[model samples]
Target: MELIAKATALVGGTIAFVRRMNSPQQQAFGTAPEIPEARKQGIMTLKMPAAEGWKDGHLPTCAPGLKVNAFASGLDHPRWIKVLPNGDVLVAESKEQAGPPKTLMDHAAQATMRRVKAIGKSANRVTLWRDTDGDGTAEIREVFVENQNQPFGMELVGNRFYLGNTDGIRVFDFTVGDTALQGSGEKLVDFKPHGHWTRSLLASPDGSKIYAGVGSLSNIGDQGMEVEEGRATIWELDVASSDARIFASGLRNAVGMAWEPVTGKLWTVVNERDGLGDETPPDYLTSVVDGGFYGWPYCYWGQTVDDRVPQDAELVAKAIQPDYALGGHTASLGLCWMPEGTLPGFGDGMVIGQHGSWNRSKLSGYKLIFVPFKDGKPSGPSRDILSGFLSEDEKLAYGRPVGVVIGPDGKSLLMADDVGDIIWRVTGA
Candidate 1:
């Protein structure tokens, strides 16, 4: 019976693959053939040397046309970053652990003797940096908050600073200009913890509600689909009422969300379900309509259903497919909609951080992409704005970009490089 089931699954998957090959969406699978190699051409390019404990103060000059500057460093796995109104930068440094070594030892002995060393004993905190004296270097460094469990996304709503941690949403009565963040915050929503514990939080434009991105509890539905209440969906919570409800469903792992400036619609970048193959399900960036269903664990990228899981034929028919599908396994993160009329070159653009790929055999997506938005929607193909974070030889990737925002200066772009442990500012010369 097991053999029969496996054979049936294989045949079904083959049929699905063939059907997808013939579809128009197949054109979206490969990288653009005309994408020129990105030249290093900016006034400055800042990098944090990873070898030096990934600390804040290592000054190094990059290739010509790139200037290297340093912000606050000495952080452990900093995930998401936000620039405040006062030009100070707030970074959420995630805690890190060294797991047991992969070696041939007595399994029982290894399990018993391995002591998991925790980094960031003093790092359950968010740190702020400011260039106080106008020397183009950060002079003031301070801790914003302490004892938070793996905080990721952060937003400023009025006088309150909202944070999305591994557990839930938290708020603090803090201002960007305040010297210290010493106030206790109210917990907005409590989420059940599972796989991929980091949650990305954003607020609606009017500050009436909060949007939290909850990733899938498992990779590709291995954890069983019955527990579907909190996994792989964005939950909308009322700020004043603290009432929570599902805003959209069927997303595998939506790590980033932003409010589009032109349309005021909620947009998200999703790290889609993986492990059918390297290129099975493409990661996506889409305008998330309220009450919309994006196919996950059941169907992906439209009508291609997963053969590993039994399909709900009724539900599959109702899922609203994504608007823009990025290439497979790109690990899309840190979405920001460029304010419509800000930059002249970019009429209205969507900037996405492609955190790069580890699951695939081939290296792809170690750069930032700019998707032009016409009127209020995505138009044309996404172009590479920042590149070469990875070595051209593909032997090493020095940085993984996780968060991006229009800098406080309103002309430059601020990006968080998690692996490189530096905040980079890209400005047009």
Candidate 2:
């Protein structure tokens, strides 16, 4: 028994060291790593945190001059958040579903996914939380929108409430202070369903058009590009016509997006394809341009070609390099900007919610990072606003940070903890 235990320990140690032989996150941040000699892999690394909930009354640690509290708790699987005009906050509770595996590699990815509690029955709802007395805690709460299909993003335009679900976009007529979502909603676009899931929606500044990003059906277009007809692309949807057109192409998974305050250009935090080794292809934050392409299965981080796909010289040549790299496999998801001098200390930059790393042996994210924007361009090192979600021993996860937004009052910050099943509020001390 002693000899067997020693053998197991040795194997575990070996795997850990092998995983760390890559670029540090700092090397991947701001600029893409100069991996002139990067190794490619057909297999995805499976180093995930054990899904565990926080103990009662316990909370995530906050940075100095900031205090964190459970603004609301007891949620099913709160993944995304939207703040309304009347100080009401909407939280989307949803889960993902995957098709049966057709290959050994697919089966293995599914198995690792199960270990991370990545799939489950759809919650299919969005709930409203309101702090009526100007307090941080939500005193009134109710189910705002129910019977939805794995909804992930929400937007409000005029009297309409738009929701981005797993398979389509739903729109409803709503008032400023209504708690219940009354309208049945109209589908703006029907998607191919499942795979990467979670379509992110962002209404234009003028509110006449909505920009959305649809994730690919497969990680690296392994299931064939035919299934990815409208997938893996950003869409420009006209509100009046309900007409959707491809805005950009070749982003593997554009999960979170925002418009740069100065440049007014749309930006996205893209989850790049997996199976490339730890340092090969870095997940990036790029300013999206209409008709532009960022290579997914063909090329990565500019013209550094990924040998996984057939040579497409024309497509590779047109692929634009991302503005900044947010570290490899960081799973960066949320984006909200606070103009300079608007908020004390944290003025004039974007706050990104990095949901942590599952593929790296040691976690890379699991925190809210502040990326400073100087004169409309990302500059300087990223700062951690909140962290310590992993346990002291790093064996279990207390929570995973997902959606982040500047509070309705514009003084506080709100973050959705999907794994912890709660919404955390951060206010200045």
* Best model number under TM-score: 2
Work out the TM-score per prediction. Answer: 0.79, 0.93
- 1-429 in candidate 1: lDDT tens per residue? 234334433443444344334323332432232211222211111111122122354332232333445555545566788788888888887743323434322122222211111132325567787878754456787888878877777888888888887778888888669866766788878876646666888889888888999988666676578665677899998877879999998888888898887778899998876545445567888888888888887887766777767788877888877778677667788888776444445557788888776434344676777788787777787777677666655444567677888776676666777767777765543
The lDDT, on a scale of 0 to 1, for candidate 1 is 0.67
The global Cα lDDT (0 to 1) of model 2 is 0.80
Task: Highest lDDT: give the candidate number.
Answer: 2
Q: What is the lDDT of residue 93 in candidate 2?
A: 92
RMSD of 2: 3.4
lDDT of each: 0.67, 0.80
Residue 249 Cα positional deviation in candidate 1, in Å, after optimal superposition: 0.9
Clashes of each: 2, 1
lDDT of 2 by residue, 94-175 (tens): 8787777687655555555554466667789999999988888999989998998889989999999899998889899999
